[model samples]
Target: MKNKRLIQKRRELKLTQKQVALAIEISQSMLSLAESGDRTLDDANKIKLAKFYRVTVEWLFFEEFYD
Candidate 1:
């Protein structure tokens, strides 16, 4: 499933994909893919995204989606 919360949080923060991707050390395309549920985020990226978004990993990747 797509990471709707992730997308929502990013939008709530008024962040562009590039801004978040750069902060998380991932390519914007990769972030887009993950958000769209076309790809899974690895552990490192999951952690980075959770941290950058100020959320828990569980909150970000809920219900074992990419866990």
Candidate 2:
């Protein structure tokens, strides 16, 4: 499913897909796919996103605890 939380968090940080991709060492297209629900974030990237967003991986990937 599309990760609205990820999109929201990225926007809240005033970040772009390119910026987050570069910071996490992934391709911008990959980030785009993940955000769009065409692909899921791998475990490593999940950790990277959590760290970048200053949240836990569970909070980042699990909609049940997103808030």
Candidate 3:
């Protein structure tokens, strides 16, 4: 699934792709690929994003399904 939560969190914080990428030490294009779900975040990057957004890794990357 696409990382809608990640997109939402960034938007909610009024952050630009470049801003986030710079803060997290990645290229803007890399972050774009991640946000678009064309690339997966490795564990280290996941931790960085979660910390940057003040959320848990699960909240950033997991989708809850209803039974």
Note each model's CA RMSD in angstroms.
3.0, 1.3, 1.9
lDDT tens digits, residues 1-67, model 2? 7898889999999999999999999999999999988998789999999999999889888986745
Query: For candidate 1, which ten residues in a row score worst on lDDT?
Result: 58-67
Stretches off by above 4 angstroms in model 3 are 65-67
Clash number for each model: 0, 0, 0
lDDT per residue for candidate 3 within 28-61, as digits (tens), equals: 9988888888999899999999999999888888
lDDT of 1: 0.90
TM-score of 3: 0.89
Residue-level lDDT for 38 in candidate 2? 94
Model 1 collision count:
0
Per-residue lDDT tens digits for candidate 1, residues 1-67, read 7888889899999999999999888999999999999999999999999999899989887946544
